[model samples]
Target: MAQQGPTAPVPVPKAGSTPPVSKPVREGIDLVVNDKLYRHTGDKTMPLLWYLRDELRLTGAKYGCDQGDCGFCTVLVEGKAVASCTTKMEKLAGKRVTTVEGLADGQGKLHPVQQAWIDEDATMCGYCQPGQLMAAVDLLSRQKNPSDADIDKIGNLCRCGSYGRIRKAIKRAAATMKDAKA
Candidate 1:
């Protein structure tokens, strides 16, 4: 049997030589979603929409119009609607993020806005409805009696041309919420 020679000593780079490349350090963030605390660790520069959809599996926030023109990725950050497609994770630390999934009560009860959306049948292809509903919820919270211009200011484009239905739904939701408060 041939004798195997001792393995040559592994080459070690001198102290001044280039150090081995290390993996990029991951960052951690604390996010409150649907009144729940969630810890996330990953690239801080990633889009919030991607983080919500890919990591947390909250797929309600769509990825349409990643350029920020369309409101397909709309989400409520601390009760204000923001486009998640361009929102970086670093900007959302310790912030409350509300997607379509978070709009309802914890008991799986539909929010008045969601109920009105269903009643009004505001969805067409339904691709943009999540963002539309998110934006509507934020808007109604501030403006219980929103004007046509106010509805237009939501800036959520419906390629399926459900704008009329969306406006009606917002009005219906406002009425329902107002009635509930009374």
Candidate 2:
């Protein structure tokens, strides 16, 4: 073994030392939910539904389909109806979100749409009612005295086939809201 070359020393791990685990860097995200300001510093990829249900404990918006097609997780974001399941937290900065629980007044007076839902007996299983009500609220906010075609555009599905009743309730709620404004 003539002329041995110098070998680089290998770094050895210390005993009882654990490797550092990397956590996702959380950024401050701000939004208003149901007239309350919320500041979240968690995974930015989390959907609004998870923030509402798991973090905020506002469960009125049911989890029917994780995909946006179902409309079961519909909520109002910045006064527009949106599928909460598909709305990521990163997109909600400085936005206002309204859930089904926010439909009632501070004095416990039911929103016209909620009352109409009850008066028209629109619920069969009641699982889809929250999403339906939120969609109706957003629709009525934009369109006054919506036509049958417009009502059909709400797009929230009821497994119980309560379309007729839902339509009637929307009409009634629109009338009630209009009268209240006048």
Candidate 3:
């Protein structure tokens, strides 16, 4: 009897058949995302918002509108506030990116801004509090005494119409920060 050869596996297309296009290999880069070292395996175009929320599990920055119109995804890059939803992870190389998680002290005590929000009962639904607190931290870091107009210009919004309380919280935080400095 003749020796039988092994049969080759058949390649079959599904109901809708389309040839796969060959995509170029993406250049991998090391990112110190949210103060922790990480090697991102995705394309350079991957936004920092998804990386923080999805990959690193840092969910403080909410994804409200994928577009930059909403400030829910705000985060600190090199101590300056930037929207993480549109910020690319590749741009954060060697820079200290601070999220709401980094706002607290090593003992896990809430930052003054965070405590002020609690004290003033600022957060309603609390979806936007992280971004609000981050923006407030940036504002107070630059100007210890930010005017009402300055607070308004920072672009912190609350859908629950907690604007009054938010303003009060910011003011209280500023006072608290000033007293601490004194």
lDDT of each: 0.85, 0.86, 0.80
The TM-score that candidate 1 achieves is: 0.83
Please tell me which model should have the higher lDDT, number 1 or number 2: 2
Query: RMSD in angstroms, all models?
Result: 13.4, 15.4, 14.0
Q: Which digits, one per residue and each the tens of the lDDT, describe model 3 over residues 1-182?
A: 56323222123334376435387633555554444545565657878888777767789999988887678999998888889999987787646678998788868799999999999999899899899999999998899888889999998678998988988999999999999989
lDDT of 1 by residue, 1-182 (tens): 56433222223344477435487634567677766666566678989898888777889999887988799999999999999999998998878888999888888899998999999999889999999999999999899999889999989999999899999999999999999999
Please give each candidate's TM-score: 0.83, 0.84, 0.81
Report clashes for each candidate as comma-separated counts: 0, 0, 0
Please give me the total number of clashing residue pairs in predicted model 1. 0
Weakest 10 consecutive residues, lDDT, candidate 1?
A: 3-12
Please state the error at residue 156 of candidate 1 in Å: 0.5
In order of TM-score, best first, we have: 2, 1, 3
Best by lDDT: 2
Which candidate, 1 or 3, has the higher lDDT? 1
